[model samples]
Target chain A: MKASDGQLIGYEKEGSELWLWDDLPELHMEAGYRIDRLLHYERSPYQEISVAETAAFGRMLVLDGVPQVTEKDGYIYNEMITHLAMVTHPHPRHVAMIGGGDCGPAREAAKYTEVERIDVVEIDARVSEVCRLWLNRDPSERADSLTHLHHADGAKWIRKPPVPIDVLLIDRSDPYGPSAALYTKAFYKSVYDSLSADGITVFQSGSPFFDMKGLRITTQRLRSLFPVVRTYWTAIPSFPGGMWSFTLASKGTDPLLGCMDRLPTDTRYVNKAIIPAAFELPNFIQSALD
Target chain B: MKASDGQLIGYEKEGSELWLWDDLPELHMEAGYRIDRLLHYERSPYQEISVAETAAFGRMLVLDGVPQVTEKDGYIYNEMITHLAMVTHPHPRHVAMIGGGDCGPAREAAKYTEVERIDVVEIDARVSEVCRLWLNRDPSERADSLTHLHHADGAKWIRKPPVPIDVLLIDRSDPYGPSAALYTKAFYKSVYDSLSADGITVFQSGSPFFDMKGLRITTQRLRSLFPVVRTYWTAIPSFPGGMWSFTLASKGTDPLLGCMDRLPTDTRYVNKAIIPAAFELPNFIQSALD
Candidate 1:
């Protein structure tokens, strides 16, 4: 494609060649990746799911045309989303993950031996099936004996959780379509009721640059529902903005004092020093939260 | 553009409509922004420079098709690249910036009342001329009394002493073309020689995701020269990968012990809490540094 100056600016997708493009329409920006091979494609009751292999990020899972996770950088998101709350709670025994059909968060939670049961409520069972086949290549890597996969609506399931969740992780997509209800105050109140006294819940808050309003609203909602609320960020290249934020709402436990030293050494993103560091917001972001 | 499945993927550059496209060819990924109006375009002795106004980012300055600064988000990069080192140094009076032709680093340095002199050595006089007109809209905002703009090759200029630089900032583009020599060990040694006994120098390393090798090598080269070298990062949505890294090398002071409490209150991105927070590297990045 040629720019206005007739300068050869960008490459054009050739006919019959597969390429995945993600658009941040609100920000007037877009990112494109070349797909080497299409591994899986299906239209579930919820959203369109596709798995493609690319040289840059290996196998990538896309939901509703949005790149969800990739073999290369998925660990960063999974670890950041799970480990913070997991380590924060003194003794996280019962864990629950909502809408994480890909099982990436479940995989990270399973690393802790003390966790007896993990209930993953995903509305679409097809995502779990496809990801198991392509993304999660090693079934043995996950603790099958402890993890319970329930293909139920997370919003409904969270209203009456089977167990009191010590570390509740909401891994839903953007607040749109079926996931819109999951981001509401009512759903957050349900999450608050379903957790233990010292329980902590962490969920993706959206990109700070593109969705600061969403982030601010999420923080405000979480603050109203929980005693302690903290917003942290992590970098995931596949995400619309490489920097993605997450809000941790707890009944009692302080996220900044999380037992990061106990963080599994296998993690690629979260470490002891980075846990508190993530909570430190830049001046602009802090102003938004204020 | 259409995907292989006949899906409309991305917007096509229309006739006479300007769009800036930045390609990270090595990563097989690209990001594009819609330009509203073209303000200036020039081919100086160094490289291609263009300034345009965009709806999302307002006015943007592009050097060789790469977006350097935008009216909206330029503060993040300027504050991050400048404040970390500026705050780290105990009493930064004389500062030298190499290749920050846009006068951003100098403007940031001028924020400090103690900073008596700031010498900006830029190779392209056209960059300063264009940015002075478009990006740096307020000339009086800059402490012109304490600032000096020199149009010269930074590599050659740094070889000779230009007063004892308490804080040296290299705000050049990526390590290619005319900026290649600035990344060499010899130039870094020249920088080391020109600093005060307790001087601090910080420069943009690269994007951690797209340029890990480059970041690693830069950190290594700086470690070879300075007694204290620390790597930190900040997020800039317009920049490729959104997350950008910087390396700080000091003669005596520790970056983590920077006087962050004295950070300018008017700044947008940098704050006391974020100073130490920025120094915290994720496990994956720490592994790269190790």
Candidate 2:
């Protein structure tokens, strides 16, 4: 009774086990994990959030029918998106994570002792509630980085915050619908203006393989606003195209030039070597932007 | 109505569309491709070979329920497997391709004028015949590098060739079943013996993400024999784990040390920038092998 990644959630429907394939129509493919059971599913105020436990990949959270975060490889995305910016900044005390309602990135950001406070601005509160209550594996900590949550537009929240942010990590949905505005150059300019002098921003660009135009155009736009822009990638097995791209932008600091003198030892994906290696964009990807 | 990547061979079954996911049980997941129609399927004396026309990616060739080659990204694998070592060598005269039954590797090798001859030792003749007949888009030439096809066991053929190979490319299936011997130290010893004094060898190891042990151990064995060994990677979007690792070994000339002076201007994947970047192993992979 084993199935491929796109086995479409169930074998015989109607009364059988309910399964789902997060259909990526644009890519003409769908991706689904092997789920032991669908633990939770409902239409939130913004998008549909479904949480399921998989026999292979632990727990998987699908939002808007997209496999947003699975317990298995969520750390890879979370670590790269958050730590790349945090480590790049010499002294990152305050961090702002946008749309990572799952609270995975904040959990990792909180690991740094240098981080004094974190402001998580998410468009959806239900995502944070479900993840905090049932989805996420309890770290069993007294006060973790799941600290402040702003159920408001992330684009607007960055315009005027209480204090200037040192690191901004955009962990939002695909660049579509309300998330589309976050991808614009104006929004990035707003982010550039509302930051400390040495602040760094990291955001998921898109799949460099299939969505070449989107990634290429986005990087081009960022280059216009930021003094330094670097593109890096990692393989998320559950996501469509498998290869996911993220761009790092800094006003004056080059992420590649900014070295990790003091590094964390406990990480499965991100290590000292990857900081430089990941930035080495392939020939096709480099050409795609050109 | 839309099929997944591995759904190439099965669709519109009986009357309704019943897509099949080619389960890579080893990886504990299946893969599929969008299929407009199934072109051909039969046992090719060695394994099952199926040809299907896809909507997103062009033609797909599935071997033993595995979508081994797709026209969309076929050049990526073929170029990386062949050109990485070809370019590494100063002058590759005689190239021996083992287990590339589809004749794809030889077709790439034939492109270089410096390559006088290519001996394609494929155990499965039917794969070459099938590809040449239907799957391959020919270069419109008579007697290309694919002129010579020695349909024999690659493991045995490497022990005693008519002339020693200047460059040896192992383009076989995974290190399993009939292809298991090709991965052994004894077989590698034979390959080393069959190679010319400055011969270089490049072969697919395994995915570092899931098959960490396989790739690590294989690199370990290769390092014991070769003076210079380097591991590189490329992202094959449709493949399981998304990221695939390739290892390069040389008798005297190092792949990384070898410079790219004259570059091909027609390639979509391989270029001067990628030659070094690919060899920059991630910390996790380097640590796993270490």
Per-residue lDDT for A1-290 in model 1, tens only? 12123221122244655566676677777677776776777778877777878757899887877787899888888888999999889999999999867788888888897999999888889988988888887454556778899998888899888879999999978888768889888998899999998999998889887789999989988988888999998778777657789999999879877776778888788788888889888777888899
- Per-candidate count of clashing residue pairs (backbone under 3 Å): 0, 11
Question: Lowest lDDT 10-mer window, candidate 1 chain A?
Answer: A1-10
**Off by more than 4 A, model 2:** A1-19, A111-113, A133-147, A177-181, A184-186, B1-20, B111-113, B138-147, B175-181
Go through the candidates in order and give the C-alpha RMSD of each one to the true structure: 5.2, 4.2
Interface RMSD of each: 1.4, 2.2
How much of the true A–B contact set does each candidate keep?
0.72, 0.43
Best by lDDT: 1
Clashing pairs in 1: none
lDDT by residue for model 2 (B79-138), tens: 889888988888888898888777777877776778777898878788888787776786
Question: Which digits, one per residue and each the tens of the lDDT, describe model 2 over residues A61-153?
Answer: 877666778787677788788777777888888888888888777877777778887898888888888888765774625226336778989
Classified by CAPRI criteria, candidate 1 counts as medium
